[model samples]
Target: MFRSLLIANRGEIACRIIRTARQLGIRTIAVYSDADANARFVRLADEAWRLGPAPARDSYLRAELILDIARQSGAEAIHPGYGFLSENAEFAQACADAGVVFVGPPPSAIAAMGSKSAAKQLMERAQVPLVPGYHGDEQDADFLHRQADQIDYPVLIKASAGGGGKGMRIVERSADFPDALASCRREASASFGDDRVLIERYLQKPRHIEIQVFADSQGHTVYLFERDCSVQRRHQKVLEEAPAPGMSAERRRDMGEAACAAARAVGYVGAGTVEFIAEPDGRFYFMEMNTRLQVEHPVTEMITGQDLVAWQLRVAAGEPLPLSQEALGIHGHAIEARIYAEDPDRDFLPATGQLVYLRPPAESDSVRVDTGVQQGDAITPYYDPMIAKLIVWGQDRAQALARLDSALADYRVLGVTTNIAFLRRLAAHPSFAQADLDTGLIARHHAELLPPASAQPALPALLAAACWQLTGEARHTAHPGWRLNAEWQRTLHLGYHGHPLAVRVTHHADGRWTLTLPDNSQHVLSAERHASQLTVHLAGQRLHADCLQHNDALHIYLPEGLSVFTLPNPYAAEADAQHGDTHLKAPMPGRVVALLAPLGEPVEKGAPLMILEAMKMEHTLVAPGPGHVAAFYFAVGEQVSEGSDLLDFVLP
Candidate 1:
């Protein structure tokens, strides 16, 4: 085995690779950008080097610099984790030229499979079943439109050079094809520097299943079963599991063999994923092959009792396959949930900020957390905002999902918004529990999945906020004479959804209280504190809630969901309301990618006016109502501050 291995990546995957390398008694080297100097992955490696600035193009994506660092550090191999330079075939070839083993497929395989159109053609020549589509090189707009019309409506426009749902759009109507194509092309160019796209027949209720294939330098390759990645948001998978819920033994073998054949067709080596789109009838079509490890690889690891990272190390060291295809069998069911720094309520837009307080569930045999961040880590807008990958194993899918839901509820993050609550609801969703999964699951049940905001906070959460306020008062004042043997009533001030929430609370000599809601509802409260938790007896029912007070925000976690209440700031609230009611300010921090509003042009309600690119996704800003473009404050490509006005318009 190579004595020193360099991880050419950052974040959770980098840390994940280091863990396996250390286990095999190999020294690990980590490379980081300026933003990740103090990141968890950096601290975990035996040696670390700074690549460049925070932006990926200046740092992690600098393939030449990474190769030089590996040579200087005497690293025998470089492991490119999923994103960044992982699938860059040119980098792989460069590593080979430097005499450093690239712990992935040979450059020839990567080059053959890197482009979607090329890969589809190669798969066709190799006799692998493929989805019918137009994989041509003609990039003329008219030509593409004709292809779309021929394929008919409800076709998928996919970027020829990228995956991960980026640069992908689904056109449902012939009239919308042109606009969708424009948007898809822009996104593809920005994401992969390639605007070339192909048209394909869209799948209705498609279940995404992928085979995990591994190959060694000894010309041996095997498939370690499959993972169902059907649940998605914005085309990115949200939930994944191994040993697909309804996969038959015969079908599994067929798909497995097809995946291996696809890999061998390109002379593949190391770890790669062959993804497929399957219908309910068990018929599947080839989608694309990821030339590196996948974000949801932990599910495969749990079911097969294999350390895929370790396998990569062994394979890169010219070792034979660790376990043959016959020896690998599904041991148990496993599921993985990707925890991201995003707001599911806000179109699942990525969020950026300090991780004020993060408490992931402790790891064990059945529960695991793969994270590149720790408490106080800042999630910047320069890269992907995935916080962690939460994986759990059980005897079956039901048990695995149940454990996943429980673990999600236990996880906590503050300072910035996250999708933990959304994840919890998704896992416990009735359809999901029954394995009624599809790629459109999130969109189909959007109403039930993302319910409207409640007008008032729950009684338990209100009590917790009251306790937080009283505790702070108690800690700050030296004398307790104000409430010492007497009852006192005061307004509990808190803010939720940018609105002030005031409730009347009366504290008595006994460990009991009377609470009145804003709407005049009353409740008798008896809360017993146990360290950081509380057992509240409210409305004659005993309920346990996890509560924490941090940085003026009182986070009360209930069995159903998490509610955060901040000390009421009337000034800030008024400002926010006025900003929304008067002019449209930037919802989230991002750069103005384009301006759609023409000067002095009258616009109807919901007219697209501008596009803000933030957190690596484009968000179109629309006119709230009929209005005339009165003024422009920011130009295209200008960085706009959150809550700042982008333009001012006169309502007609």
Candidate 2:
């Protein structure tokens, strides 16, 4: 359609747009911040432009800079890949004024539907079913409390300009409304620049179902079914699937019709999603309309076998709708897991580091991985820490879920912690397998779904580490008789993912080894090394091991996990505390949005200190103890590469 286009985003979505654009012989230009200068998306683009510093405001969110990049790169259009300026009406209007196509809806539609409060009002006038709530602009505390009382208890206070769970709070009792509203407004103001909010009845056990609608300039709109994104943490979706499990044909038709009506009423064009919150009783209501392509569009593409990005470009080029609602059909089930660089064990905190080793699950006909990082790439604190999106498809829901589980298990990432284990556990859980889940399911069964500490499987790894270390030491025995000494024994200290394991390997004269543990369990083992297979015999059981040596340290890969150990060389010096360089840090790598206190300020225990935004969600980092701010390493707009110190405090 167009000669070239600039992608106004980064990460997997930008890479995804590039893939489809290439398929259509369209040259793609990529814009990057300092953090993403070396990102895979930039390398994959036909041309690239440096936006600004790492902070989003100076780069991704700068509409004028993006427009200038498009002009300099000779890009005829701009694709605001979800988030950032994707939903900004002013950005859309700016593109229109610059005579460049904004591959999204009209600015008028974005302005009308961008605000949740305004969208709800317009939906009501368009005869669309809406959740009963207060949408008035009265910000008076008492007036809002009165409105909440009228709507009844268990109401949701949502930011009028928010999406992705920002500035949203749920109040269970009338007494909690005041505090919740205050907190919600503060966060709303900080995140969206809009403190205006609305109140709605909080639906319990709600399943978030949203209909995918695509339209063109011809005023023809078609529905692409729906995606169920109920599996979430803090209102951010973890997993998404299309053709929701147990969805009846009748309900699908009804929701699709309603979504199309909403789009047509606003004269919506291009790819957009109409989100609805469906109650347990099967009743659904219009929540809001996203004015651009969604992050989870791959799940929809997998089932429909249509390239949504290509459609976006074609629509922007003034093409008419290619398929009508009646012709569009979903052929299979698709599930997508948002693989984030986060530590699931530690409250799902976001993590940051150089990706020393990054191995996504092996690709196949039924699976797709949308990623934007490469090995040795650094995940900075200036952006979302989502490493990639894993999409799996199958003939049905059960098969898709199983494939997704296996895919997550095969994923491997090092240098920084990830939620792969957490995702695998959730996908394999019985409740998830049966699709009996909701937004709160993860929190409800958090203990059950958590990676079991007991199931970490370290014995095999310990044995490998011990065997490798002992064999290396025995190879250099000073005395010839020392090699044959039955009493030759040494303690091996091995390091696992991070924790240390003590292993005692005693090599006997008979060319066998006896391993003893702190738990008093003893195993006799024999080792046989081959080019490909390393076998270890323990007692009467024979097991395969993958063992190697790197930098004089023994490395062993077991079925469960990997282990590393140093040889018991008497001359080898003890390891220094320099290894502390890599320690526990903030969750999903993102810029510090706010510092709760001034530098050198004293704070009470549990007081909020800093707020970090990642994966489109904000995480408030609180003081661990009563302390005085020792240092503030981040400014309001400075991009501290993830793990870069946000601040430090001295304990009082």
Candidate 3:
């Protein structure tokens, strides 16, 4: 094994690599950008090196700077953790030229699989089943339009050099193809520096299944079974599971062999994943091969009882295969849910802010949490807003799904919105529990997955927030005659979502208060506070919750969901003007990608105006009401802050 290794990534993957490296008695060096100076991964490293500014291009993607750091730190090998330069073939070749081992496949293999079009062609040659598509080099608009015509409607335009769902567009009709292709190419160029694309026949009701394959320099390769990642949003996976539910043993063997064949064709050495789109009728087509360690590798590790990172390290050190296909076995079912700093409502726009409070499920023999942020860390706009990954294992699919829901219920985060509630709902849904999955599952059950407006915040939170306020202001321990002259009751206003709720609390001599609401609902509740934690007793049941104050809002972490309450400003305020204003502003911080309307174009109520890209997704701003574009403040390709005025319109 090498004496030292450098991790060329950040966030949870970096921290995860360090954990395994330390267990193997290896010293790890971490390279970080300006945004991650005090990050958890940097603090966990044995030695640290500064890369550059916060953006990926200035830091993490700089292959030469990383190579210099590895050489200076005496790291014999470099681990590119799953993003940025993970699949960069030039970086792999650079590592080889510097006499440092790249803990991944050969550069030739990466180059072949880096392009989706090229990978599909290679897989076809290897006899691996492939989806019907066009992979020609001519990227002209007319050529693509004609090819789409031949392929029929409902085709997918994918970036040839894309992964993680960045540059993918699905068109249902012929007319939408041109606009989709333009958006797809723009995203492709911005993300991969390549504007070329490939058109494929989009598969309906298909399940995304990927086989985990490993190879050694000795030409030995083995399959670590398969994972089902059909639960997705925007073509990116939200949840992943190993030993796909209802998969027969015979089909597993066939897919496994095909995966091994693809690996052998590329002369692959190290860990990689061969992904496919499997039809419900059992036919599968090759999608693309990830040339490095995957983000969801832990599910495979949990099911196969093998540390893939360790395999990568040992293989890079010239070691032979750890275990053969016959010796390997799937022990149990495992599930992983990616916790991102995003709101499921409002179209799942990514959120950014500091973590006022965070508490993950306890880790043990069954539950595990892979995280890279501390409680006070900030989720800046510089990178992906992933908070952590929660992994659970059980003896069967039912047990695993049950454990996943339990783990999600116990997870807590505040200040920044998250999708934990959405995940919990999906994990416990009857369809998901029965293993009925597809790429469009979330969109199919949108209304069922999200809580109704009435169920957004439960009634218990109101009592909890009020109790917390009473305790924080030291009113709970007031004099015995507190209510003697106050008409035996006191009313306080608690703001929830900017609306005030008048709570009437009637103090009783028995240390209990009768809480009343606008609905005339009354309950005798008692609360005891110990610092920021509170325990409320209602009737015969007891409940505990955490509360904090930040951003002029009271953040309450409840079992149902995170609730925010604020004491609205009474002396300083203005009447809302959004109802009549004609100015268009950005809802979030992002870069203006394109402007559709000219300065004097009359747009309909819902006509597309401009597009803003943020946190790896594109959001289009449309005309709120019927209006004519009067002026534009920011042009395309300029970075704009949240709430910045982008356009002013004249009401029609």
Residue lDDT tens for model 2, 1-652: 8988899999888999999899989999999998888889999999899999987778888898899878888889999999888989999999999999999999999998989989999999988888889987778989999999999989999999887777899899999898789778877876677889999998888899999999999889889999999999878899999989889999999999999999988889999999999888898999999999988999999999888999999999999877887788999899999998887877887777888667777898799999989889977656778899999999999899879977876676667768877887788878889999688889889998774455223466555644564455434333324653347777665544444556666778787877776575777777777742477777678887655554445545554444455444444334323223222245445657777777677788778877776644567777777776667766765544544656666774
Clashes (N, CA, C under 3 Å) per candidate: 0, 7, 0
Q: Model 1, range 1-652, lDDT digits (tens) per residue?
A: 9999999999999999999999999999999999999999999999999999987889988998999899899999999998788999999999999999999999999999999999998888887888777987888988988888898879999999877888898999888888888888888887777899989999899999999999987789899999999999879999999989889999999999999999999999999999999988889999999999999999999999999999988888899989999999999899999999888998898888899889998899999999999999999988889999999999988888888988998898887889999988888889899999899999999999998767687664466655664465423223424766688876666678666677777777886777778888777777767756777777678888777777767788876678877776547667766645437788878888888889788889888888988755788888888887777789987998777888876786
Q: Candidate 2 — what's its lDDT?
A: 0.81
Model 1 regions lying over 4 Å from their true place: 473-486, 498-500, 519-521, 528-531, 535-543, 576-580
Off by over 4 Å in 3: 455-458, 473-487, 497-500, 569-575, 578-581, 649-652
Candidate 2 scores a C-alpha RMSD against the true structure in Å of: 4.8
Could you give the candidate ranking by lDDT, starting with the highest? 3, 1, 2
Q: What is the TM-score of each candidate against the true structure?
A: 0.95, 0.86, 0.95
What lDDT score goes with residue 613 in model 2? 63
Q: Is candidate 1 or candidate 2 better by lDDT?
A: 1
**Pairs in clash, predicted candidate 2:** 349-587, 350-586, 350-587, 350-588, 381-590, 381-591, 381-642
